[model samples]
Target: MARRTTDINDIAFGVIRVRMRLHFMLTPKGDRQAVKYFVIGHPRNGTTTLHKLFVANGLNSFHDSRDWQTGRHDAFSDFGQLRPVAGYDRTYPNARFILNFRPLRHYLNSIATHHQKVFSVQNFINEAYRRAEYFAWALDYFKGRDDFIAVNIEAPGAVRAVADFWGFAVKEPPEGLINNVSTRPKLEQNSANIETALAALDLVEEAGRGCLVSRLNGARQTALLAARDTIRCVQ
Candidate 1:
């Protein structure tokens, strides 16, 4: 018998069409209010959890999905690895930004592990490090801006903080992390390489201070401590 085959392009096109229909259906009929929140964060950083919380509270929120046609969502989260495009703030003048922060080591580990599992190879280390730097850059670039609030999703009270920032009430935050990839067992194998690459990047020390850096090892701990001190000295 001939081997069965699947047309990947056809499947991709079908998915796109489905997404388009979904977006159209979710779009508001009348001229609704402008977007209230824009979550500018790296991938796998609890954006999904946050989006769920928002929706459960009756807010229309979407994660990692852009809707250029409708522009009717109450909140938007997860733009993947790339930093916010130029004039993002200008485009959404009234929209506030929720900047999510994650530790460099853990962030890279999760992404690398996920890539390894999905692609059957491990080559996302550089891309992960680049994303980490992008997060750091976003923090510095948006510093002191009243419209932007930086929060580490791992922290306890993060959901409440975000709600307070947005002038709303969330009776309960999500219990645990969401969209998290299983990477703990693989961290030992990947941490050293991730640490080495991150150390070389010109990351903003101040931004590093606010992250939830995991206690991976002495070297990683020392680097985080140094970065934290740099943030203090500048302040």
Candidate 2:
């Protein structure tokens, strides 16, 4: 009927208008503003998983922040090392944000046991504190708003939830779906570093840093020799 045709036209026009508004928000300054979504927050908490979902669903996505700055990316994952870039949302008010996370020990354990970065336990503790700050600020700023979503990728139906959040059809699972889940395995670190790591950890935990820093004492080091009481309990 003519009425039905008119309704369809109106819907199509509305969509176009939205895209036009977004396009006008900023000139194509760099790889940054071209993006419509910024999947941010600490690593190993499903940041990569969320990004893969976006790309698998056919959105042109980039994983690294620097990579995004060099090209026209529609979605930028892991915007900063462990934080969102300043003024991104205000610059692109139309952009959606996803803060992905997992259990605290699980996150810390991943960082502690990372094959490449184990030598820097102090850095792990430092970054954990930073992640907590980001979460505190983000939750306060973005909670209960439709433009922002906090996704626990480890939670049940997380992938489906993300797809639903974006209203995208998942004809196939996102490529690179593996999450590199946390595990318990003993790893060796220098005793001197362990002592310093724990000292810094205690300081952060006292400051009310979240779960990631609270239980680094024995993370998954059950099998290690008693002399090696490092935070290698979870890997």
Candidate 3:
């Protein structure tokens, strides 16, 4: 017999579930507080996997940014707004934030290749350079926070680390059961040569340094910086 789902989070991703579990998850999440979490990561960074992880643990999660408004999602990810959540703690006590980042060269190539499905690109070099700044800034902003964590999505122990941070039961993460993949099982494959793509774009030197911090207004930047400094001093 087929199982039933109560949350809309289970309904929206039905048409084409990418980088997500191909099977339905029916794990019962016991009662818990109303703490909300927002994942900070770009496309192809396994944000979908993380979203499903929360869903598997019984937290109603939304893959889209706007879904948080329906009052259904206890978790939110893939928020394309590219904005900062500086005072989330003040707004919602015990709110959690998570960031997933990767090296710039790989990131540039991954996104460019992902976009190749729709609009052809010479390698999305320009867009990569811009996004690199945002990621870098976000990494620093969320750094050293008590309720925030940053992880390397490609790392073997990445799932364990995130589960630990959230205090989920220590068990093997379920199989990704992806609907499709041309390359990485967790992500859709790209025919572009990783090395050739980076070299062709001439992003060699800029690979190490990137993040998009442009959207931050002066007040937010100052507050984030001050908070980080204070947190450091206390430690």
Worst 10 residues of 3 by lDDT: 18-27
What's each prediction's TM-score?
0.60, 0.59, 0.58
| lDDT (Cα atoms) of all candidates against the true structure | 0.54, 0.54, 0.51
Ranking the candidates on TM-score from highest down gives 1, 2, 3
Displacement of residue 149 (Cα, Å) in model 3 is 0.9
Q: What is the C-alpha lDDT profile of model 2 across 164-229, one tens digit per residue?
A: 866878732646466766564535563334445546555433322223222333333232223122
Candidate 3 Cα errors over 4 Å, as ranges: 1-33, 65-67, 80-84, 87-89, 117-123, 170-172, 177-235
Order the candidate numbers by lDDT, best to worst.
1, 2, 3
Model 3: lDDT of residue 194: 40
Give the worst 10-residue stretch by lDDT in candidate 1.
Answer: 117-126
Mark the regions of model 2 whose C-alpha exceeds 4 Å error after superposition.
Answer: 1-35, 65-67, 79-86, 115-125, 171-176, 181-235
lDDT of 1 by residue, 19-114 (tens): 655655565533333655767677667788778768867888767555433355667677533423333455556667776766554566666676
Point to the candidate with the largest lDDT.
1
lDDT, residue 85, model 2: 36
Candidate 2 vs candidate 3: which has greater TM-score? 2
